[model samples]
Target: MMRHPFVLFALGTFAVFLLLHLAGGRQYVGVLSGTVVGGAGGAGLGLLYALAWFGAVLAAPVLLLAGLLDGALARASRARP
Candidate 1:
């Protein structure tokens, strides 16, 4: 849903993983693979997975804050009469 920014970020990260896998199996193929950074690419996935995980974790709080703010605004407006 449009209200869930974390989901969008997660999907985007997954898309990146797919792209990396398509480009070639890790092994410092380029700046795109996590192997280039000396990470979990040994299994053909590292950077992209970590990125998606962190992005979602971080975005969850932001999404929650936005929801809280919107709810507060609605309640405040209703009390104005």
Candidate 2:
């Protein structure tokens, strides 16, 4: 699983999202609703947090599926001969 590039990428994406969320990153996400929680410096951080959330929500599952498929195919091919 971890040997596959897609899997590793998905894991990395999820890890980043988790870390940010744990570090009170969600406060920044309020920016999306025009709430701006942390002031001037927080805008960029908010954008980053939003992007990370999107990536975790949208890209991570696809990546994990791709990785699983790739790993299965590799194993099947190796076992054939």
Task: Report every candidate's CA lDDT.
Answer: 0.54, 0.86
Q: On residues 8-80, what C-alpha lDDT tens digit does candidate 1 reach at each position?
A: 5456655665566565444444435333554445343544444444554565457566766666777799999
Following a full C-alpha superposition, what root-mean-square deviation does model 2 have from the true structure? Answer: 1.3
Q: How many clashes does the backbone of model 1 have?
A: 0
Q: TM-score for each prediction?
A: 0.39, 0.89
lDDT of 2 at 59: 100
Task: Supply the TM-score for candidate 2.
Answer: 0.89
Q: Kindly list the per-residue Cα lDDT of model 2 for residues 1-81, writing each as its tens digit.
A: 258989999999999989888877878877888888779768767888789899999999999999999899988999996
lDDT of model number 2: 0.86
C-alpha lDDT (0 to 100) for residue 31 of candidate 1:
37
* Residue 54, model 1, lDDT: 53
